[model samples]
Target: MAQNIIHLVNVSKNYNGTEALRNINLYIRKNEFLTLLGPSGCGKTTTLRIIGGFEAPDGGEVLFNGVNITSVPPYKRRVNTVFQKYALFPHLNVFENIAFGLKIKKMDKKLIAEKVHNILGLVNLSGFEQREIDSLSGGQQQRVAIARALVNEPEVLLLDEPLGALDLKLRQEMQIELKNMQQRLGITFVYVTHDQEEALSMSDTIVVMKEGSIQQIGSPIDIYNEPKNSFVADFIGESNIVSGIMLRDYLVKFAETTFECVDHGFKENEPVDVVIRPEDIQVVPAAESKLQGEVSAVTFKGVHYEMIVQNNSTRWKIQSTAMAPVGAKVGLQILPEAIHIMKKVTVK
Candidate 1:
């Protein structure tokens, strides 16, 4: 079993009169790429800051390897942070930027040189050592920031939406690169991002948060496939969430029709929320489909068509390679496994 490198016990934070984090409990495994994922104002960055020792929690304790570090200063913790803006000094060259931490520690010049040389090679910027910060592109600057953090040889690295400044293509490329680097280095990575795709692509485990509390924590596949609630299903990916009733094991009723499903363990006649991914729905001829609807809208999404179909009063977003023109009648076929049932949320 992987050991827990960091643990947050009933951690809470408040700013002004508003609550930012409400009883957050999390455990990060050693050498795992974990992502704190949520939309803005959801406390993802606040949690990261707390873990990095930049902010103190109003309640609870932070444990690193079973040792409480709640009062430890940021500089004293064996962790480094890479901010979204990179924070590279404009006056320093790439080599100097990476070597800045070592110099602050008053390390031997030869040792700093060796460490800088090796990290530059690790980030694939071996020959760009003397290049000025302004001379590098956005992606290169991100690499320099990561290299600087890694040069400190910290046990854990905290990243605060580090790819937020990059373009779509560059951000996608960096997602893969960062995941590979984490595997190669075998160090714990606590990454913060609002981008769902980034969390899905790079994380060994994803902690999905909303409104200052965690919604779910699981592997990407698990979180994407078996969401615990409507919030998680809707946030993790494109989902068609609708009210439904579980008729029995392997049977559910939604859209005023009963359909076979692969989920069970629900009480008979229990109210639930049903989720079906856009990609899981197939468009077929209206005459052969279980549900018939008219194509209300269609958009060319490069690799596939993003289509909206209206069945009664429900609008379902579907992704398919087949182009169904608006006003055309179509059938939506969903496999049994595609039907996900979540418990309904009750309000006080």
Candidate 2:
């Protein structure tokens, strides 16, 4: 088996009196695109910085290819970072900006030119070598930043929200481009972002963090479909989490109704949280419904209609293609496959 490209065991970081990371343990496979996803101030950036050797840990160690690099300087580490703002020098053209690192390393001019040219082509910036930084658009600048980093042929690329500066459409375009580039080059990429959609769309594995600790780590489907806790369910996507009591191995009670969920291992009568996405709720005629509700609001979404339904005691959000008039009675149904049962955790 191939060795893991990056590893962090029991790693923690503290600033002043506040802990920024808490006992992080992870192993990143070679040539994989892994994302550190979480809300702002959730230690995602801290983890990236620690791996990049920009910040040292308070305890534990960081390893690269089984080598302990906990104390390695940033420049000596086989990693390169691309910041959100691109950070290219306005006075320097694309070629100079990308060739700066190799120049500092005293690489021969011929070698630098060859490497820079290849990277420019790799990032789709081949013809922009002499273009000034200020003369490019946000997406163009981002490409230049990526090209500059890849010019060094680092083992891993750390992108700290490199697409955050672009407009929505451009950002979406770049996401696909970035994924394609990673696959084509077969290089490891460690991306940090708070954008849940981006994480879901691009990551091979995702580490979800909150309050300086990891909430969950898994594939996009595992994190989205089988969230281990209420926080993970609520953070990764839009979920309607309802408090319920486990009746048995497969039965749960919520709002005076017993639901058959395909989840197990809960003690009888234990309080659990059930999560169902908006799109998972099926809307049917009042007389044929399993879960009856009253329509409180309805809005047209180009592809589907979003309806807010209330069960007199609780409001539930639902999405459907069938339009329902506001103030009408409707029945809500959640398939067994859509119900996610999780044990709730008290926030510290």
Query: Highest lDDT: which candidate?
Result: 1
Position 186, candidate 1: lDDT? 88
List, residue by residue over 69-171, the lDDT tens digit for candidate 1: 9999999888899986789999999999999999999999999999999989877799898999999988889989989998897889999999887889877
- Kindly report which residue pairs in candidate 2 clash with one another: none
Models 1 onward score TM values of 0.94, 0.94
Candidate 2's C-alpha runs over 4 A off are 106-118, 121-126
- Worst lDDT 10-window in candidate 1: 339-348
Give all candidates' CA lDDT scores.
0.92, 0.89
Q: Least lDDT summed over 10 consecutive residues: which range in candidate 2?
A: 118-127
Candidate 2, residue 152: the lDDT equals: 79
List ranges where model 1 is wrong by over 4 Å: 134-137
